[model samples]
Every structure is written in structure tokens, then in C-alpha cells.
Target: MQMMMAGARTRTTTTMMTTTTTTMMMLRRVWIPVLILMMFGITGGEERTWNTEPAYETQGVNVTVIEGKSAILPCSVHDPTSADNKPVKVVWTDQWSTILTFQDNTIIDDERIHVDHAFAREWNLRINRVKYGDQGIYTCQVNTEPVISYTVHLTVVVAPRLSNDGTGGMLEVMEGSKAELVCNATGIPAPTITWFRKTADMGERRESEFCTGTSIVRRYSSFSQRIGEAGQVLVIHNVTRFCGGIYECVAENGVPPSVRREIQVKVKFMPKISLPSKRISTQKFY
Candidate 1:
């Protein structure tokens, strides 16, 4: 009985030793990597350094400005890692080439182009004296890990302007012939041309007239008549003496300050002679 009890005690001691050895090996396996990471200055209590990339806070926008005026394109970014005091690189480009670039107090040398950075996150591009050619898509880019960009569409408005060459002047036509009067205009949105005719006394009259051969319809008002055809050319078929008058052409668009031009049409015909006493003329010859 004493021998059996001693053998049971020895087995219990062996079991405890094996359990301790297995525990120790498992702890070493778990702590080895942690110790190596600590040696390289990595710790769970430290603040994380990796951050998400910079992103645009606002979507792309459309900007409209009148010609010869200043235009502003807006761009804003939200950078999570900006607090680390790292340099942020910004670039502005168009369809053709790079307009400007900025990084660490560096900027493009352009008098007409300006970068407004009054707000830390806002980067607004300003262009002075914008022309028609400046109207297009402008892109703002940030130099990030993969790079991010925002696009802005610019529209330039131009007022209507009438051309003088072959557009307006004295137009002469023979009686019973066709006459064409042209009014040329140039503008950004393609100005609409309208023709008007003024009467002799400039009095108010209500009448509706229509012409053949291209079909010009005119609605007469008190002072002037609005030609039915809304085109650059005014067509008059079978022109007579009544067709000779002062015609005005107006070019207008949504833009302000419309333009107008006046043209005088002269219809020429042979003079007709009238004799009251046709029989008396024959007795005088005898």
C-alpha cells in the first residue's frame, strides 16, 4: 500500500511539471514578436501615424462670368494627415497645359492667375480679365499617394456685336426684283437676329403682311413691323416702290447690351409719262 501511494504522488508531480513547461513555451511564442516590435519603437499606446488620403470636400462646380471680367474657381480639400506638418502639393491644369503649381511657398509666376489661400483648406483659382478662350474645364489636383482631382467648368458670356462689313448699308434693287438684306452678328451664345421695318410717317398701324419666295411674314405694330423671319438675312421678293424703306436689324442674346443696325433700301424703276390731250397733239403737228 505504501509503494502504490508513492507511485501515485510521483505521477501527479510529473503532470504538474509538464503543464508548466507547455505554458512557458506558449508565453514565449506570444511575447517574442511583441518584444521585437517594442525594440523598433512600436507600441500600442502611441498614436497611429497612418492616415487616409486627402479628399475633396466639395464636388465639381460650374462657374460663369462675363467676358473681360474676373472668374473664380473653387476647390477645397479635407486632409486627415495634415496635422503632421507635411508639405501639401497643389496643381492647377487646363485642357492644354499646367496653369500653376504650389508647394511649400512655391507658386507659378503669372500676373493674370492668382491663388487664394486665405482659408487653409480652400484653394480658389482667380483669373483676371477672362477671355472667350479661357472658357473650358479646369482641373485642380493634389499630389497624394494616388493623387486626387476636382474639375470645374467655366463659361464666358459675351455681348452681341454687329459687324459693319457687308452687313448694313445702302442696298439698291430694281423694281419687280428680289432683294436681300443681311445683318451679321457675333457673340458667345450665338446672337439671334431680328429684322424690323419703319414706315414713312412712323405712325401706328396694325397689319399682317406675307411675302413669297422664302416666305417672309411681317407683323406690323403702331411704330414698326417685326419681320416674321428670325434670321440673319431679310428676303424681299417682287420688291416694289413700297418696299423701299428704312430697315433695322437687331442682334440680341441672353447677355446684356443688344446691338442694332439700320439699312436703307432703294428701289429703282423707269419714269412713266402721261398725256392728257392725245388728239390735240396730232392737230398741232399739221
Candidate 2:
């Protein structure tokens, strides 16, 4: 009886040890795989979230700027190229030579031109004090295996200029004789000239004498061919004392302000001789 009882206790002890070892092995199998899967999920999420790739985009076709001012040439990209996540290199050139260079997100030694980038996408160039020499085709190139580029045409507009030989002022004409006043102005757009007279109240008085008015008949003669532009002309067929005043020649070409000049006309006639009345030299001298 004592031997049998001892054998039963030994079997129970062995069974308990075997059960504990099996539970430990099963726990390791479940938790170890779970930890590994969690680590992989986290790593994959990071990789997908932080994807830095190069993309290409177009900004514009052309840009216009005024002379003595600034100009901005725009460029863009869908993805920025990089070697080791470094900023993509950018270069700006014209038909002649290179104007700027942007490498590692910084400008090079060029001072007249620079980059104006924002939102990590915009790649625009700023040209300070634009000149006529700056007008041309500009290209923006990216340093890529198969280099991507965009071309933009730049136009520089110069302000309108005007010049004249300083004529048409204070014209003196004899009565019954023809009078002609000429106005000449030079500009980029070939300025248009109009003639008018000044009134006593500082108002414009324009009529048959205008440069663009119809022909006026005077004493059976037509002055049609007399009034035209070859430098603009204002002709008076039969000059008289009433036909003299201050004439203004206004020249304009869509510039900010128009240019004008004033001319005075004086009609001369034969002087009439008048006899002085000798009214009794009042008082003495008799």
C-alpha cells in the first residue's frame, strides 16, 4: 500500500511540471508574433507617410515687366528631385547665358537675380531693375537624369518718349494773307496733334481751324489741303484781326500725361493816320 501511494504522488508532480512548461511555450508563440507584427505595422506607416519624391509642374508661358522695375519669372514642380533627400538643384538661363542657380535650396553668386520660393513648391525668380537687355526667352531647368525644363518669354516695356524741334509760337501774319502754324512731335507711337485756341475764361475754343476739322471756304477758295498733318498744320485762309489769339497744340500718345505748346497769333494791318486836336493848350502859352 505505501509503494502505490508514493508512485501516485510522483506521477502528479511530473504532470504539473509538464502542464506549466506547455503553457509557457504557448504564451511565447502568441506574444512574440504579435510584437513582431506591431513593429512592422509601425515601420510601414512611417515609410508611407514620409515619401519625398520629385514632381514636375508648369508655371506660365510668358511674363511682362516694365523697364526700371522688377520682374518675376515663375516655375513649379510636382515633385522636387533630390539625391539623398537634399534640395533639388535649379538653374535659370536665357538664350545667351545663365542668370541664376539654386542648389541645396540656396542661391549662388549671382546678385541681380534670386529665387522666391514658398510652400516648398513655388520656384519663382526675381529680377531686380529690369532693363531692355533682360527681355528674352528664359528657361528654368532642374538637375535630373532626363532634365525637366520650362520656358517663359519676358517682355520689357519702355515708357513713351516725345521730342520736338521747338517751333510754332508767336506767329505774325499780315491781314488778307494766309497764316500757317506747324506742330511737330516725335515719340514711340507717333503722337497725334490737335489744335485749339484759348478763351478769356481759360476755356478751349476750337472750330474750323482744328487740324482734323473739315475744310473751310474763304472768299471762294477752299483751304482743305491747307489743314492736314505733316507734323500737323493749322491754316487761316484770310487772316484778320479777329482771327488772332492763343493757340494750343496738344500732342498725346496714350502716355500718362499729354504734351502741349502754346502759340500766339498777331494780325498786322495798315495803320490809319489821326490828326491831334490842339485844344487851346489850356492856360498860358498864348
Candidate 3:
């Protein structure tokens, strides 16, 4: 009876140890999946936060200016909260290189270019004495996580100018011959050339007045009639004495200050003489 009791106690002890080991294995199987799921949830949340994009408002613009004038390129940040407690950095660039930069309350040094930070949200660039060479594309960039930028196009306009070579000079044509007059001009928007002819009466009066060097000129004395032609060249078909006078060429565009050039045209013909006695008879060796 004593041996049987001891054997029963040893079996009970082994059964208890086996039950504890089985419970530990089951707990590990359940907790391992739960821990992996928790880790995955934490990593996904972090990725979504990092992938979010900042919200800011900006727009591209077109700027126009006349030559020898000032130009302004505008840029503004509508929502400063997008920076998220970080200082904002701004940079201006052209096709060639960087023009200006603003960071930490400091701006890069440049001649004829500066930031007009009159307002807290404004970062406008001002250019003094703009020239034809300054016309092109300019970019305004902000250093954000993904970077944001705005583009501006600059257009420079110039007034019409007449060329000097063979533009205004005296032109003589024979009777019943064709005559051609040319006027050359250049400008930013391209120039439109118009031809005008002074009337015979006006031409004669202007000539007389000019010869006398008179200051006071008669009204309508310099008036001219349009030739109903537009181009760099004006052609006269079968020219005659009526076509002889002063011609004016006017070049104009949208820009200010139109230009003009004057040309003088003279017509020549054969002279005729009549004799009283069938060609005057001359005495030979009288």
C-alpha cells in the first residue's frame, strides 16, 4: 500500500508539469500573432502620416513692361500653416541661373533686383530699368517637402524705330517708268509701315515755305493723302509728273512714339522745242 501511494504521487507530479508546459506553448502561439498585428498597425499609421502633402496656394502670372521701365513679379503664400512651425525659404531663378533667395530673414545680394516684402505674405521681385534682354521665364520656388513653384513670363516692349540706310533720300524716275520706295523699321511687336503722298499744291507751298525758312506755316499746308498701301516697299506703276512730290512713311505699333520718314520724288521727261521757219536757217561762213 505504501509503494502504490508513492507511485500515484509521482504520476500526479508529472501530469502537473505536462499541463503547465502545454499552457505556455498555447499562450506563445496566441501572443506572437497579436504582437505582429500590433507592430503592423503602428508602421502603417506612421507611413500614412509621412505621405500626407502640405496645403498651400500659389499661381503663375504674366508680366508685361516697356523697355527702360520697371517690372514686378509677384509671389505670395496664402497659407502659412503649411510650413508647420518651420521657417519658410524662398528662391527666385531664371533659365540661366539663380537670381535671388530669402531665408531666415536674410536675402541674397543682387543689382537691379530686390524683394518687395511690404506684406508678411508677399515676396515680390522688382526689376529696375528693364531691357529687351530681360524678357523670359522666371520661377519662384519654395523649399517644402515636395517643393512648390510658380512661373512668371516677362515681356518687354519697344517703340518703333526707322532704319537710316537708304530710307529717306531723293529718288528720280523717268516718265512712264516704274518707281519703288522702301522704308525699313524695327521694333519689338514688329512695325506697320504706311505710305502717304503730299498733294501737288501742298508740296509746292511747303517747298516755298521751307526755302524762306519761315516759322509760321499755313494750316493744312503739310497735309498728305494716304497711298492705300501698307508694307516695307511701295511701288508706283507707270510713274508720271503727277507722282512727283514729297512722300512720307509712317511706322507705328502698340508702343508709344510713332516714327516717320520723308522722301522726295522727281519725274523727268524729254524737252520739246519748235522752230518758227522749219528749223532756223543759219548762214554758212558769213
Best by TM-score: 1
Per-residue lDDT of 1-286 in model 3, one digit per residue for the tens?
9999999999999999999999998887666545543432332343322233333355788999989899998888665434245445566777664445443232334477777878767778788899899899988766554456788899999999988856347899997888888899999899899887765565454543322112332225455566647898888877765677787788998898888888998889788688676666686884
Clashing pairs in 3: none
- Which pairs clash inside model 2? 54-79, 55-78, 55-79, 56-78
TM-score of each: 0.66, 0.52, 0.63
RMSD of each: 23.1, 26.5, 24.1
Per-model C-alpha lDDT, please?
0.73, 0.64, 0.70
TM-score of 1: 0.66
The residue-by-residue lDDT of candidate 1 on 1-286, one tens digit each, is 9999999999999999999999998887666545533432335555433356678888999999989999998888787244366745566778664445342222345677877888778778888999999899988877554457799999999999887766347999998999989888999899999887764442322222333222234434524566548898888878866667677888999888898888988889889798786554455653
Error of 1 at 199 (Å): 3.2
Tell me, by lDDT, which candidate is best.
1
- Candidate that beats the other on lDDT, 2 or 3, i.e. the better one: 3
lDDT of 2: 0.64
Q: What is the lDDT of residue 277 in candidate 2?
A: 81
